[model samples]
Target: MNTTHTSRHRGNDTGTGATTDRTNPPMTRRLSRLVPALCGLLLVLVGVTACGRTESSGATTTDATTTGSELSYEAVGACKDVFSRTDAPGAQIIVLWDSTASVADMPFPAALAEDLKTASLDDGTLSVIAVDGEAVAPRILAKDVALSTTGERDRPSVAKLAEVIPACVQSVYLNGLVPTAPGTDLHRAMTVAAEIAEPGATVWTVSDMMSTSGQLALSKAVLAEPADQAAETAAADAPVDLHRNVWKVSGMANAATPLLSASREWVRDFTRGLCRGWNASGCKSIELDPVNPVRTATGLPKDPVPPFPAVDAVTTATTCSFTLPDELLFDGGSAELRGDVDEVLNQPLALLDANAETTLRIVGHAASSGAYTAAELLALSKARVQAVRDRIVAAGIEKARVSSRGVGDTEPLAEDIDPSTGLQIPEIAAAERRVELIIEGAPCSR
Candidate 1:
């Protein structure tokens, strides 16, 4: 069996999408015959018997809580520790099962969703959105009420979610393996999830990510036109603001095979990097611990600072300086890059012109709030740098002069207290997502 999963934002201008596909020999060639039985058991265990009333009224409209204090380096580090533990706060996990024929018996999506629900979020909330392969749109599986001011769990919302999830699962089963589309519209589903989610929510999606259609859908969602025109038409429409965080779980061999083990590992790595000041581009920033006023007054040595690796790398002999804009580099406790990165890169590229001697080196960095393991950080850093490199090359930079590198969490730019925000800051991790231009030889006149 083969499965593909794709995720993206929809209904907003935040153009982001991810896709993955895996191929492997069937561990259960014989088990292929047992898919029906296994799938039946899965439905019995996780299916929904009822659909809750649509939450159309009195959904609490509370402002997302923002810690006024800058994310201190210490705080970032602490966040990393919390994210990596099994006891960490639970995250809202959304599973979109392809009802397509290729993955009719795959229990992997359900199993992974269950594991994520059970994963600890400490004081965090968990929600689920499950879609049937046969359905034209995704269906809500589960959700909890907004984390309340008093720290009490909203049992009503949780109960509602629990009730709906099984029904949604059953819906998938009843639909019975319609031919899986070449791709699922994961982007649309994710956009729906983002709109429904509270501000600052974390999202995890599990799927094989095999569909080209799904990928295209995600891309379209990310680049969708801003809703300003529609909002203006509504007299009472306040400007719509959108923000969402997404982590993708890929590398599963087939849609039917359970790969929760691998998916969990990826999620763990992704979250750690996110909370530790990894930027929206999936690059880490140099984070600094907040200067303790008392410690400074008492002349104590600051908290033991972790050694960061030097981020400078030689890419095709171009010694380029890599840096990130202070604002877009890192946001509090998240790895998704903020701002239009293509616009940001344009600034530096403009400086280079089309000089023949100018060689560009795009270096990606992953900062740590102390959450990401070395391997995870490295992957995030490399991907971000390469993304920028790809953009630069596409924008017309010479391929020969352009190269990319990932410097995993090894450099610092400022005190971790985000200069923009007064709170204790994460380490200066954003500087790592930088592009450098080396003027090799001299400018070549066109």
Candidate 2:
């Protein structure tokens, strides 16, 4: 780190026959003042430069000023002791980072960087590698370097480690932000880590476990396979030699297409097989994390469209019902479906599609406001139900699988009369006016 220096010159006249006044300070006093200033400067240099060098470990320290980013103080405080107190401090550690767009919301890189602070060993090595579409050289952040057991060497050693580890992590994170890598190559990355690992070493892989373009490329078909079968397929794609080293998979995020529970189980089983296969002792640790919501669209209303209430489906063991308000599906006194009803109807359509044997029933109800005669109300309700049924059939459900009915103003979802005065409640009456999709044989939970 560079420190700016400021100097001021005070001149004493050096003319011929000119003599110094008695008020002038003596040489010793001036030297004493200069000594403290020099000591202060030395302290600043030590703090910025990792005290120049370590005598015991011979570890090289990089200048922190050269790095573009540094780890936050809170992160350091929270993770300083994570790896330091482990039983085996002499184990070599290799970290494989997923440097792709998938890391937009991931925190594994920063977390690993912090934990590495206390995890270093005086005789062990620490390496960080970026996993991307193509292979790249691993960055050896620390070599045979550990925090000092004695107080004299501890501070500088920590300072040196703080710089290099975070610098490497920052590089990985920045790469993910503006990803040039086309796809994820998790299998190759793990292979590299395994090759460099010793018998007792630990290889850490931080990824979403979704390989889009590689020998181990993933698809819906792969995810649909049974756990063990999927594992066998992954192993055949890229065989790895773990050398009996431990493999730890962390932050396996969800893919957008598959459901969360399915994706989580598939990844967990797949990784377990990869670690247990290829001469590895066992899968040491694995963590499955939900992909951050920010990385995916929420389907929330934007500025141009006015915000409305969200639609939801109610389900039982053998039935699912989605209630669409009459106003949302059909305008006042009209049986024709509205143009904007597709988005609202998709919620129920998804539930029906999930179960192939499910059957759909569209039932329509009308409010009894005395605006039409009983015959007219029944006709209107039947017409509305038919319109809704047509849309469901058009969405690909077989005509035989769908049925329609209308109750007119006979079946009310809420009380239409006020018991005290026998007067009608407008809000309650409105609540009864809706079209309900009753799905039979649909899965209760999805």
Candidate 3:
């Protein structure tokens, strides 16, 4: 796709190199011829030099050995160079900053600063676009900033960009850090990246990559779909064709509250698919920088709750059962309900309210493993379901409408014991331990 730049702030640094179009061929030829005489005069004056004028050729060949003695190697410079390739004229680096509420609590990535410090943008532009909402535009952070000043005439034999580029990045990044916005439209952010990106530009999407709102909103229901299907469905909202650009997603699976393993995996897969939808030259994700001690995720929503884990549902014309795995509601060996159980019970409670004739039956199961004696296991199971029944009754449901019971290690989905060693399989045991909420006389709507 053709790259369209909307930013009037983008500065084209002509000093870096020549343009592709040959506007004045005759003048160029005359200058080309005069170059030999000038080189010869310079050689005579210096008394020792190559005729090709290698030192003044403008291109400084990178040498690992010379980095320490001739030039100080730094991490920031390396990160900058990853985006600002000296040979790619008109290249720009777009930082798709995600200031959505989901990541508001997270501190800015510390490694980003170190990585940027070692970069030498030379003549590249660094731009920042807030992934604030679906419509935010790109802004110039360091327009046409020269990142390195090494070599003769350039004289960088001792120079480093350990300060300049990082300072620019920090200045722009900090200035833009205002109160957090609500949504994370990653597809929209990527489209903006493409719109503002120059050919060969590298786009860095720095956020949790959770599209929580808008057309590309990655709700738990959407994330529940098969990875490829979910990705394709989201991509269909706004597809970007990045002909030669690169897209890297960082700060994924990171939040004030740790995300579920399934959540992380689904987001990774969805983003991978989204990147493919954009047709980027290269795609990188979940590549977060080291935590910045000063910028921890303190802005998280108060008592933040992750989306409820998926539970198995059984439905009929008049009865519905939800199987919530034990880990979701209790600590191992404990019957007390988890702090989040109230939220988890919202659905069942609502269903009961809607159908006044419905009666709730809570049944708890225990793993058959040797974690407890059969009597203890049975007691624990009974207490667990009783806790759930208490919660439902507390939520304004009639106490008489709810009945609870425990079935200890009687119905296992998998073999709890290994025939060879007779040891319980941890996974099977865990899976076997679950509580089922059965609602009778009403059809569940999901």
Kindly provide the TM-score of model 1 when superposed on the true structure, using C-alpha atoms.
Answer: 0.26
Predicted model with the maximum TM-score:
3
lDDT of 2: 0.56
Q: Give the TM-score of candidate 2.
A: 0.45
Full-model lDDT, candidate 3: 0.58
The TM-score values for the models, in the order shown, are 0.26, 0.45, 0.48
Report the poorest 10 consecutive residues by lDDT, candidate 1: 297-306
**Highest lDDT among the candidates is held by which one?**
3
Per residue, candidate 1 scores C-alpha lDDT tens digits across 263-335 of 2222233323332221222123212112112211122111111122122323333333434432333232334
lDDT of 3 at 156: 32
Query: How do these models rank on TM-score, best leading?
Result: 3, 2, 1
Model 3, 299-358: lDDT tens digits are 532222235245677889989898887756764458987776664677788899999999
Per-residue lDDT of candidate 2, residues 24-71 (tens digit): 335224323322222223233345422444433444433222222433
Model 3 earns a TM-score of 0.48
Ranking by lDDT: 3, 2, 1
Clashing pairs in 2: none
